[model samples]
Target: MFIDEVKIYVKGGDGGDGCVSFRRERFIPRGGPNGGDGGNGGDVIIRANKKIDTLLDITSKVKFIAEDGGKGQNRNKNGKNGRDLVINVPKGTLIKDLKSGRIIKDLKENDEAIIIARGGRRGRGNAYFKSPTNQTPRFAEEGRNGRDRWLSLELKLIADVGIIGLPNAGKSTFLSRISSARPKIADYPFTTLQPQLGIVDLENYKRLVFADIPGLIEGAHSGSGLGNTFLKHIERTRVVVHLIDISAADLLETYNLVRNELALFSSKLSKKSEIVAINKSDILDTETSQIIAEELSKKISKPVHLVSAVSGNNVKDLIKAAADLINKESEEDLLRLSLPDDYDAISNKGLTF
Candidate 1:
């Protein structure tokens, strides 16, 4: 039921027509022009809401139209303006032009809104043309049409850390062990067909959001298996936890395969801060696990942590490592914000001020 992408058509309301009339009274022999102007049409707006988690509600109907303005009446009575139409979508939704495939806006914050279509203009009445040369002008202008377009909405989940690896790498089990989220788990591959999100509460009231993406296989970037469909969900993650099954025949090859797939999908995704963890360590002896970890660390040139999700052995250490790295990166980001906007560009040129 988690719908992330949807296409819809939106249209603004049309303006009302003007009226041409002449006033006539019992006492007055010739009255002046008394026609009224038409009202303007309504606009189509799209807003972001934090409470809404999916685009399923918007899929119920494809086309959305605003209310049209009322026509002008006699006695100089103007028509009523049309009401604006507001559509609510989940936060982190990107509105794109379907025809041009260009991104219009990224709704990352709640309450953010944008007017997608503009309403037509109102028409003029005969009274507006009443001048000295044409005292009894009977001409009236017609209303203009509204704007319409086809838009595509794509949703990307926001998370602090992403848990990624090949299928059946204990990702679901690891996530369940650390957070309250309950995702379906099984021994078979592709058990998690969709991405799962969870919140891990750390010490000092600090928390981190994690997303467990579906397993990646060979040719994932090319749309093989469930990789391409769900890989985009990890693009927003600040950090990634690479989970590897310790029982794999070639640990180094397994690690490289997933990394290559990530790089192929997005260079930015592969360059993110990564934490390598060997899961299902409870099956092996402590000394044996440590030896394997050390060997893998030397081969990959990165520290390898061995943890068992089932027994909860050394899992806290892994979480602590992720939190420490996240805090470190956050501090760096804050420091960068405190500096000049061109600090990086200026420093890279080797210019001394």
Candidate 2:
């Protein structure tokens, strides 16, 4: 039950009413206005919590409201302010206006919070109305109303590398082999219903985060076969591992189908450098596997590595190639991050992680 998108209603608390009373003490002969002022209302806020991994908890509920302020008391006392309502969501959640479809905020960092709705202002009491011209003034200012909005929350998973291919292409198997992630592996399509993230350890304590997206079929961009529902998870990935089951009869068509889906979905995703891996090589003869890899490389104009997820043949080499590419990209990201904010011109030239 992994939910990445949800719509909700949020409202701020209303301000309390002001009190209009005069001091009536036994000792005092003529008491002036002693009414208390009303307290301000509470605000509605959404915070990013890294501990949260999904939006299932938030999607369960539809509306969120803050507490209203208490009314003012006598004896020039101020009313109590309302408590603020804080909603916790996973990191990478984007807050958007439902009606306008505009992104309001991107909560990417831990503990980051944004006030979605503001509280109302408190009213003024009649205590300060006493003057020489007017002895007793009974007027008071009214409180203001709180802000309300309809917000849409969308979550995008954070990963360094993305693994994408047609169904039964050994993506889940490859992920399980490289990392501790154990996704369901069956001889069928759509084995992975949800996206899974795994951390791979390289030499010198270096690590790379890989995201395994659900298999994409033909017309996936057009809402067919998962309908690009999970494609957004790979937008942030720096690299894409294109794994193909070498035993497929139409190897080149499978490659083209996935590529076209990527392009139709987004240019950014299609432009990412791919590490084409011809999987299931253990089941195929060496000569046949080489021919497939060579043909694919020639068609795509890139080196295609051959590997077997079951027998672990040439799997290390494939992983090593992915690691090398990741290292190079990671260094470039570090350099761009280290640059001063004023060096925008130079930073723009560097590639993003």
lDDT of 2 by residue, 1-353 (tens): 78888899998888887888888989997788887878888999999887787888987789998888777778999889989999998877888999999989878778999999988888877885668987777876666777899999888876667889999999988877777777788999999888887777666425777778899998888899888788877776777899999888888899999999999998877877689988999887899889889998999889999998788788778777877886777666633322100000000111112
| Structure candidate 1, residue pairs in collision | none
Candidate 1 residue-wise lDDT, 1-353, digit = tens = 77888899999999988889899899987999988988899999999887777888989999999888778878999988889999998777889999999989878778999999988888888988899999999888777888999999888776667899999999989888888777889999999877777777777526777788889998999999874877777776778899999999999999999999989987877778899999999999999999999999999999999999899898888888987887778666533322100000000111011
Q: Least lDDT summed over 10 consecutive residues: which range in candidate 1?
A: 339-348
**Whole-structure CA lDDT of model 2:** 0.80
How many Å off is the CA of 311 in candidate 2? 2.7
What's the TM-score of each model vs. the native? Answer: 0.90, 0.89
Q: Candidate 2: where is the Cα deviation over 4 Å?
A: 128-135, 204-206, 330-353
Give lDDT per model, in order. Answer: 0.83, 0.80
Instruction: Count clashing pairs, candidate 2.
Output: 0
| Model 1: lDDT to the true structure | 0.83
Clashes of each: 0, 0
